[model samples]
Target: MKHGRALTITITLLITVLFAVSAGCTGPVQQPSASPAVTAPAADGSSLVFTDQEFAFELRRTIGASYAGEADIGECLATASRIQEGDFESWYTEWNRTADAFRAAGDGSLAAGHRVSAMEAYYRAATYYRTAEFFLHGNPADPRIVETWSKSRDAFRDAIALDVVPYEIVAIPYENTTLPGYFYTVDDSGISRPLLIVQTGFDGCQEELHPYAMEGIRRGYNVLTFEGPGQGEVIRVQHIPFRADWENVIAPVVDYAAGRPDVDEDRIALWGISLGGYLAPRGAAYEPRITALVADGGTYDVGQNLLQNLQEGGGAPANLTEDDLQEWLQTDPAEFNDAILGAMAHDTGTRWLNENGMFVFSAASPAEFWAKWMEFSLAGIAEEIRCPTLVCAGAADHFDPDGVQAQALYDHLTCERDLMVFSDDYGAGSHCQLGAFAQSFAAKFDWLDDRMGMSG
Candidate 1:
């Protein structure tokens, strides 16, 4: 399969992503209001479709990359057609098969001396492999997690090698070891340019940020994307869990970028996606060297929101605070955990969020996970930020449906700030605008360009 392979797609269903649910919360897992009920269509339909909202959203995520060759429209539709909604095994099997097919296609294209075709095929393979591994984190011990992730990384590396622009897989020195990153430059002209540093939030890899980096590179910026503790290779290979003090992570990354001759140290910008919406802002609060910060859908207080969700849903009492939550857990952790576990049993998104949180946060159980989650707040720190910041939100954000988190973060800012909320009318209202890359990139880079005085 190749790019632009007879593709016509649309977000026919309204799907919403979920935030973690607190133990006391009681409600059906929140999702977007569905359109009129209809059977999921065949692959050759006007668009690849899914009746399951999560399935539909994720499938559209891959298909959206068709413009850049990270995904092929025909292949995504064909693979998605065979997978059963909410069936992890089926999802994994179909995507894995497609990945292997693309990988083989790339190898054959390379042998035929078709570098462009090889690059496109490898890109598709990498994305498919990543998609295959998406739901496996629920079982932390699953061997397929590492194997599929490795294939994705390897395929991405191979694809980047064939790019016309310069790309480097870098290992930046951290505490005791090195953090993996990919650096892309507009050119090797030995001229320093503004740099954009990016990291994905929980459950995303550095390789998946390739299209984001390409956006910067095309707009006369050098891009450096890395995975910190609890993310990408750091968590998978080094066994490092996430730390709330993100400045410790961002500072070292800044040091590395500042030392590079090709990076303009004065114009370094940081972007955090999804959960990173919280992480990047926390980093900027303490790291004064950062020139600008972008939180793609701001997250103010994760634990608070989770608990508040419970409160609103009648799971917990009114005005529940962190201290109250901790006291409840300490009083009878087993009982508290049972409530959370029961809730997780009903919601796939909630289960994955907590399970993945436990693994990445190094919490022993649900109670412990929520305890640690409380520390990821920007309560007193937001006002400390010195750099201009951009806080984005989806009008119908699955994780922040009310848009309160982004508004809170914006309100707390004492520095120069702007809030951009994407509306669903443009198909850019999903989490981080997953299915609308062009709109998301344009809004983000345009803001950064103006902030850095690089706007044309």
Candidate 2:
């Protein structure tokens, strides 16, 4: 019912390009007995295949909490600083060398100094993503936002797959080495890809998978990225509305993924961005079979977030006119009445931006705000995440919760959960900005690789 990242879209997806963020792997996976291929498709639209390097890298990058990544942190940091400080050329010049440095360091252990250099590379790319998001534009209703996010997602994926962690600058053989990894060990004939449960942010949907989802598939994972009830296409086209019990809603999604025989039951993981950060955790809390959980730039308390945004907007009411409500009331009171009232409540910022049925984001009414807020709080269920977890946030993120929720969630994890927060201080983006995203993603995958013992 309040403003959110959707507002910051500055009106499109092509805001910027390039972005980044990672960790370690422990052992090699023994080949499984031959079977049949699952319904999964690799990036090439064929069965999954993996070389050992690709396998190690793919798992390493999956979790999003890595302290290790593929790029040079110091170099990445410098490049990003140049771009943000208004020097694209300098950033590019430095980035080229840093990129080469990462290739040279490929699959090797990273010394702290080398790691810092790698971070610089990732940082620069991440900054680029933010630039594309904020500066480039078309319309929120157009493909720009989608295109920009896709780029941002890929940038982060790049950072993770490069050579090292951008923030910590530690060199380790981890997910950071994936290079947009190819994850299958055997041909796709008999193997099912890992089950990746992807969910969108506040206004995002399946198409949002472009960058990150694409990376996952390249690494041999069968990804199922979806729009929650009130998000992007789900709400706009499908007309599904938001609900309080977000986790409950996702339960069926998990079941749907699990029902697929090709899906590795032991490898099912929930990956969510922004709002999905909270939603994914909630789902894991309610359902324990979730093998892994990645909540990126998550919102911890909906009530707190909603209230903050509203207060920022001067507590003004929606854009809906009284007359519109009267006309809809002529229809049945049960369905049409509420629908009309929602239509009349048009001025809602991020909840839904529709002037007719729903704007894009908004509480049907303020009266329903607190009720929904209390339902999404992480206090009760965050700890229920029993699988290894990766919780990420942008320290200076304008698009998400600024790491408050992620910090809280990370602190409470009983499993091997890692929390990483990024900002200019750490050389990252604002919210889901490409700048911060690259580092954020690298950090997450690095952490995941470590937990999975993928570090060589």
Candidate 3:
């Protein structure tokens, strides 16, 4: 639904990429596994692998959330049994069915004063509702998108209302409006503590970031998570597209947090996931208030990454430099749109990527999307960051299979930095370590603890 990464088109197989948010996983790190070799072509002109890789990956993401109580193993399996393999409508139908059941159960529990049960049901309902809305971006005018997203946000808020720790729905001031957010504090003692600012990437919203906020709270750190322009409420309600200069966003967030009595201005950390990997570092480069930074699945030069993926998949000519690609996009807009849109008709992942990209970035055409993507590069910005940064990379990341983006960011950083390459042996090799939230969060927060001297 939410592809956080570039589309990779293989002969007869398209690898789906989600460059946003964590799902779940549990384990220790180990060496990387050997690449999956493509079997010999059969008489039918297809590889022996007969699977809808995109659907399978999304299913894994759903089931993986069970580890955090965001889903139930049996419930997810039962839902999958009814979903038609690659049919987006079927996927939405089944997930929404389950969400309705869960929401009803939560209502019953709350009516009986069973707060704990109500909390769990509400959380799971939120996740299912979010999943149901994933594939609806293709039609921007779909009413189901807003209805489902609102349900997810409302469910999450209801669940958190029953939590032991303090949680507040906040409105962080921006230029002409306020950004929606959730603020979590370790306690109500009014003591100043380090704050971890968690922001969403391409597809996920602030609600899905609840687990990360809880993790921060457990580690004696306050957490603030919000949806920036082009994400969550900002895009859905305000219709503001994403901006290349992210410092403006982070600076206002920091101002809001610093004004709070519980937040330590000098010990704040900025952690971004998926596309946030690029956005966070981009902001840290200019925002001097961030004491530490984490870019999960670090990205540098997203435009180049997209172009390279297209080139490798035969969607673009080989060795097309940035200048060449720009010239072609401007000179032959019709040809560019035809090539991309034609490919989208047959591939689910590509279609979602293009459609979602256009929706969030507010691009009217594919060529314009590519041009806007070029503005997000961190070529000369990485060196400007002064905070101690942790750049994370999955050994088998679909979008950055070779860890090129992470390496580029890590290599360019002049500040104290660490590059963490998570191996696939631990089930943490996917983009943003979607199925390995536990291992990913443990490693990420551990680094932040050491940097901030919060280690126990």
Candidate 2, residues 1-456: lDDT per residue as tens digits?
A: 232222222212211110111100011111121011111111210002222221212122221222223233344344343342222233334434444444344323234445544443453344333333432221335454455445444444454554321111111121222001112122345456566667765544343343565445544566565556665434444445566577666766666666666667777777777667777877887887787877775556644443334334543234422222222222223432244234323312211222211223334432233233335567666667788776665444433423445555666666666554444443343444233345544556555545433333
- What does candidate 3's lDDT look like per residue over 214-275, in tens digits? 88999999999998999998988798999989999999999999999999888999999888
In model 2, the worst 10-residue window by lDDT is 17-26
Better of 1 and 2 by TM-score: 1
Q: Model 2 misses residue 270 by how many Å?
A: 1.2
The better candidate by lDDT, 1 or 2, is: 1
TM-score of each: 0.88, 0.49, 0.88
lDDT of 1 by residue, 344-409 (tens): 666555666778888787777877876777787888998998898888776545567666777788
Cα error of candidate 3 at position 163, Å: 1.7
List where candidate 3 sits over 4 angstroms from the true fold: 1-50, 309-320, 330-332
- The true-versus-predicted C-alpha distance at residue 251 of model 2, in Å, is 1.8
